[model samples]
Target: MITKGRVTATLDGDFVVFMIGFRLNKIWAIHKWLPVFLAMPKMLKELNSNKDLGYLHHEIWFGRTLILVQYWRSKEKLLAYAKNKDAQHLPAWKAFNQSIGSEGSVGIWHETYQATRGTYENIYVNMPSFGLGKAGKLQFVGKGQNNAQQRFEKNE
Candidate 1:
């Protein structure tokens, strides 16, 4: 099991954060939606096994839409992985285009964020490790780091 804490995450410098997920527009169409849902786990497995891919870690939330929060070592690494033919992403993306192009039976989307040291702040009180805390490191949220405002002021 993982330990819980009020610690803040620590990182060397700027890192690329990617939010990627898929939605099932036509939930009844198992043929259309199943492949979309199944493809990610295979891609995730490949990424998890290869450290050079820059996939640090992920947290998933499932509903009508599935959300995956991904942390990468850098933007370049993420792009390289996405474009590499030998890698899982490119093939998946190509297949997605070929199989589900504009049909809207299944939908996929992603958002990206860039974060740097002292530019962002997070606080977790009486909660398990999560988000930035889970993806990066967590420092002790002590006397000076008790609240978000204090954390930002002191951390920056």
Candidate 2:
């Protein structure tokens, strides 16, 4: 079963926590069908392949929009993957940048959190869901009590 996992920020409140959000608009009209046809298989392969390298969690929404919520051991790992030359991600990114750089056909945006206090999360199993799925199944530990309240509470 493909499951989402809780990702907490652990940078002693220094490194920024990113809620990266992005939508990819297909130009090839024919590519409009790629998500259901080709992308799913590619995504499954990537997810399964990188399951061990601190790949915390992810989800696809609105067909073409992919929202990846991952917890990195550190920001360095995240940057490494973003800048990796050999990984499939880099090629995809480059292609997107080249093909849709001017018109915003493909857009990527991110929100960062400098967690001075703390962050908590949960995961939902056996369901097709997004970031909210993380809030469904979670157990809190010492100083990490009140998972519900924590998840619902607004970030500062």
Score every model by TM-score: 0.91, 0.52
Output the lDDT of residue 86, model 2.
67
Cand. 2 TM to true fold: 0.52
Q: Candidate 1 residues 4-56, lDDT tens each?
A: 66677766677888999989899898898887888889988998999888888
Residues 89-110, candidate 2: write the lDDT tens digits: 6666566566556665555766
Which 10-residue window in model 2 sums to the lowest lDDT? 7-16
lDDT (CA) per prediction = 0.83, 0.47
Q: Which candidate is the best by TM-score?
A: 1
Q: Where does model 1 exceed 4 Å of error? A: 2-5
Task: Predict model 2's lDDT versus the native.
Answer: 0.47
